[model samples]
Target: MEEKATSATFKKETVQRLMSLHFKDEKTKVSNDALILISELLKLFIMEAAARSAKQAKTEENELVSIDHFEKILPQLLLDF
Candidate 1:
């Protein structure tokens, strides 16, 4: 089986809206490239967390990745951030 290519999952307009809300108090403008980069980075973060959580579940002989797996990795994830 061939693996499908995964594109960034976030909508640009939604991300732009979020950015606008984040900086609503200021006169700052978010650029298109910045929004794209932010979306890509968010995707990377989520992918990394899911992979790690899956690994944790597998290590414990569990078939399903649960919130416990995510909780186990949260501290390490925050450290990376």
Candidate 2:
């Protein structure tokens, strides 16, 4: 079966942004492998938080969230990233 296009695109974009922001910092040394590892490390938290935010937005408010919402939420888990 084919994957849904919209969700696949969204996931791709989200992953790209996550890599760029978290793994591509200029002052830090990270490689492609590290990017993959870090993404994997945080994937569950991101996915869960995204789902929760989506459900909350849907049932509780008229607003929807974008990948940027997750981007903002990620760094705050620690004082430094």
Clashing pairs in 2: none
Q: Candidate 1: lDDT of 61?
A: 96
Alpha carbon lDDT of each predicted model: 0.88, 0.55
Error of 1 at 79 (Å): 1.2
The 10-residue segment of model 2 with minimum total lDDT is 3-12
Question: Which tens-of-lDDT digit does each residue in 1-81 have in candidate 1?
Answer: 565679649999988888888775778888889988999988889888998999999999999999999999889997996
- Kindly give the stretch of ten consecutive residues in candidate 1 with the minimal lDDT sum: 1-10
Q: Residue 12: error of model 2 in Å?
A: 18
Those runs of model 2 whose alpha carbons end farther than 4 Å from true positions after fitting are: 1-38, 66-81
Q: Write candidate 2's Cα lDDT for 1-81 as tens digits.
A: 453333222244455566567654556555666656656656645455776557655665548776655555555543333
TM-score of each: 0.81, 0.33
Cα RMSD of predicted structure 1: 2.7
